[model samples]
Target: MLAWTALLVAIVVSFRPTVPVIWGDTPPFVESALLTLETGRPTVAGGRDPGYPALLAVTVAFGGDLSTVVRLQQAAWAVLMLALAATAQTATRNAAGLVPIILVALYPGLLLFRHVLTADLLFAVFLNLAAAGLLVANCAGRTARCCAVAAAVLCAAVAACLRSQGMLVPIATVLVGACVARPDTPARVAVIALSVAAALALLAAGSRFGASDSDQSSTVFLPKTLFCNHLNIVLASDAARREIVSAAGDRADATMARLAADFAAEPGRWPVLGFFGDACLFDAALDRDVADDTGNAVGAASAYRSIFLAAVRDRPLAYAGKFVHQMAYGASVAWPPYGLEPAIPVSTDDVPLVSDIITRHGRAAEPIDLQGGPVRIGLLSDLPGISAYLFKALSTAFVIAVLFWAVTAVWRRRPEFSARAGIVVVMWAASIVTAAGAHTLDVWRYLVPAVPMVSLMLSLCAVELAACLRRD
Candidate 1:
């Protein structure tokens, strides 16, 4: 299964440019990588975790090129697919479970991310790894089970170090373990206790690497500015807006409320929710006024956070409804939110540090947009397909698959199938909460992890159905 998946990934990824695909945010990772290479310390200024850069640094250490890194990432994705495939097979003792993983791997939308330079790819990879490993561990011998649990914990910890949402990975593991572990066994209790403690410790350590709420510079600052823009659109009542703003203590000012209103009123100037692109911190003058009151970005963000929390508290049910709606919206996207522009050859000549490192290492920075990049249609050249329609069919099929699995699992009395679905749901929830939790806007990119997660769940469902129909 692993060999076949790897072959499929390689063949599909061959259409990608020979160079490593680079995006706007790609250089900071290279910055961190070069720093790690020179100093033997994993650190960067842009609030990025060391996990990915550390991985890139290892490639540098081995004199491996960025193109190699791209292939490695693709391979990592293949491993994730195989893990889910293995999960399905192990759960039902049937090889038919490989179907869903293959279907996921063949999805055209996901191929875009395979060779892209982003930590999100790896973060998702480690998370699914933990989920599948934990499920498999449920069926393992005592010694192997302990090792598997330990490995899953390590994967969850690495996932945490990769993204801020990584804290959710630990929770998914715990839930998955609890679902599949035998209740009466003292070892199960011991395993749960040890994993919880380990998860808590890793959560503490990993969070220190993520961007802080107080951080008002770099990428972390945008959420505060964006909330006002979204609020102007979501909350129609002036009185309600005032009540939320008033929660900010001395930091709240009439100007801040007015600025938010003003930005929303402007027709073409500011984006409503920044669903396509953020950094819309909308109007500069608006945040400037808000910032002026608090005397600095930090103070302004603190105030904005207060307003954010207050708005949630004021209409908790409304917030929950919005969250669910946004999750559905994000999941329904068939294509990536970004990276579809006509591609130019990727280059780092403008970024001296990254350029120098690439020059020395002989790595090519290539651009990849599905429409015009070096990526060839290869096998997909025949018919231009609508991704939306494809996704609709897949989603409908997935629902049917789940219904089948639920019936079979109940009739056959299989706890493992239910456990598999539980973990998948938890993982999906984690992504939604992580992306939308900041009280900003939601975009398709934030839900990149869902592509594989949904596949894993679908695989379990399909596997369960196959197991039910087969007879000796």
Candidate 2:
């Protein structure tokens, strides 16, 4: 009965919005889908991989507009809720597990996903699919387990195709599966070896999906030099960033000054400093200057990567410290805040792709403003935040307790540790690591994959706490 209620609420919440949030990023997706149809190649939304554009291409084939695509994403959101519901049910071992799932379903903030055109929502869909598949495989008998494992792997691969960082999902699953698979599991070493092989295969296949000639497609921020790599340069202290940008050939001083001023304007973002890289990233004048500086070849992207790598080599300790800080920030901000109402759109007037989007999706294409905003679902928007806080608190104790149980179960050669329990821990850890590695701060959408893990952990821990209190 609880599952049915969650399903009904999810369907209603997912479909409540009409105006898809059109923002600056909408054009590339529209353009890519059109291009994909015309060229028969897996065209990309700007520098993004083919996973999302391929999805848009299918929608285009169905004669659906941007509206159709957002609806499709909404449907996926609904499916995610159902998947989480099942996982939570298993975790809590009772109706208490449904609490988080129901809270997620009613959270008014999630509706905002319906307005954007990013691959993250779908990528998350596949991640949860893989997680649930892992659970099924772990519990299934021999023949069934083989089928489930294959299905999980294929799902993880499709996820990797959608977003580059998603490559970690399959790799994490393989590693964890090897660790927790039955003691007599055959060819355990072979499985661990296959993780590396699978990751390489996914990366190679992802690059061919018509992203861009640019060196930085689908890896966090695109246009390698300007966003993803350049941002890291900005993340450094003033001295470090100065030294890093000094590698910009002829424009070194000017590049350093421009970035310094950009960071100066924000003054508060800290680890979230990627936004400062955008002016240089999207400025046409800067692009022309860069082209002229390097004789108009692929020098700009190469230079960015070279400079970023140098920073890593020179300031390895600094970079490592920053990476750890960001990971902690990632854990806190991982809650999904997309709501049904429209958000304030970020301007993309400087971006060259705006005109192209107009041509592809018609005049209606707008920038993607997916930042957190209000929802039509009343105070329910607060539910996601509340649950997130509770989940984090619960997970700390849960993981520790589970670790003890797992060790004991292994030591005794007992079947006490359920496979479902093992995969949840692994996915939770992998999700946090992958999201942090994306090096993004404007949003934490990359962390969506970890949410199901958090929610399931919440269900399990919350129930356990209640039982303990009653017994005491």
Candidate 3:
């Protein structure tokens, strides 16, 4: 009853981005969906991940309503929150489920990604499901443990397919579960290892099934290309630049030199080094049309990889410093509510927001808009004054809660719950590093995955604290 009420309330309160949110990376996904529907094959293009597009195609095929899609997505997220809440309650064996469910349903920042056309909403759901599955597996009886582990791995595998960074989720799940399991439990270890291997195999199969067959294809996904691009900026010192040029040889030396010059003119621009700069070195590298008809995107990616590897090989310290800064930057402004295009009001005279929801090809991205007007949560957009303060306060509280749980659990020698806490900390840190490593910019949307993890884990900590107090 509480879960259903929360889902309905969340649907009503955070019903912004009702029209399919389309922008920069959205076209490829939309195109992929259309192609999938038309060709009856799970075809991926434009370096976009195929998981979300394929899902979108399949969903639309059944109902043909994008609004229905958003509602279903929100409900799915709500269901995951309910599951997480239930898991946390079971893990602590306490009356602490309601708070986590409420927090998840009411998270102001969650509103940002809920109804979008991106994979983030689904990615986050899968990750939380995996976390919940691990927690359940940790507490399950011997016979049920194996099944729980399998379910967790399946969730992690789906998460990985949705986004590249998700590949780490299965590993994290196994480690978190193992940490919580009884000592000398080799059977548990075997189960987890088998699950991890199965998940990896599934990911490999998904990639092959979704791979683009274009000869000029980079043969690599957009995520990896973006990653290599970020690495290119990290390797932008004069020595590194010269090394890259030398490595590229005459055929590509000029292009590499030009990129170096661009980096040199504004060092901060490449890695998004400073607080603010338009240093999209990564995007620029992606745009360098060095590939001909016979070329694979892999070759271009290889060039960037070579330079990045050489830089790390030659100057380890530089890489470390940049990496740390990038991670810090990523962690700083994780989930600001209104960064992705501040809500523009639709005047009676202006074009409807529904008409504007199409792709660059002018193809119908959302086909149908169920809402009357633009779905703008006015309080978020109009009053940016409190958003930062609220974000900071909540972020600080979450961090402190995580730290408190970690120290207390270690001091108490309580591995069961602490293992889950540790997983949260590690996953959050890992996500920050992944974002820092992959993107040139430090945008808040990039940290969407961390938001729910932090919230759910912190809520679990609160429950554990309650359990501890009760025992005392």
Best by lDDT: 3
Candidate topping TM-score: 3
Error of 1 at 34 (Å): 4.8
Q: Tens-digit lDDT track for model 1 on 301-389? A: 65556556666666677667666656555545422323332332344443454566465645564333333445432232222354445
User: lDDT: which is higher, 1 or 3?
Assistant: 3
TM-score between candidate 2 and the true structure: 0.76
Clash pairs detected, candidate 3:
217-297, 218-297, 218-298, 269-279
lDDT by residue (1-472, candidate 2, tens digit) is: 8666756765674465544554555666656666677767665645656777778777767777666787788778888888777766654567877876675665443544544566767777787777777776666666555555655666777787887666677788666555444324455444434544665565565533335432223332344433343455445545445544554556767766665565455444434644444444544333333333544435554555554666566666766665676666655544545442334243345234644555555444444433445223334444656644554554464555456446645776334244456676677656566445445544555565566665665565566657668889
Model 2, residue 97: distance off in Å is 1.4
Evaluated against the true structure, the overall lDDT of model 3 is 0.60
Candidate 1 C-alpha error for residue 333, in Å = 5.3
> Model 1 segments beyond 4 Å from truth?
1-18, 32-50, 61-65, 182-203, 206-216, 219-279, 282-287, 292-294, 330-373, 377-388, 402-414, 439-442, 466-472
Sort order, lDDT high to low:
3, 1, 2
Q: How much does each candidate deviate from the true structure in C-alpha RMSD? A: 5.6, 5.5, 5.0
> Among all windows of ten consecutive residues in candidate 2, which has the lowest summed lDDT?
213-222
Candidate 1 clashes between residue pairs 3 or more apart in a chain or in different chains = 346-367
- The CA lDDT of each predicted structure is 0.59, 0.57, 0.60
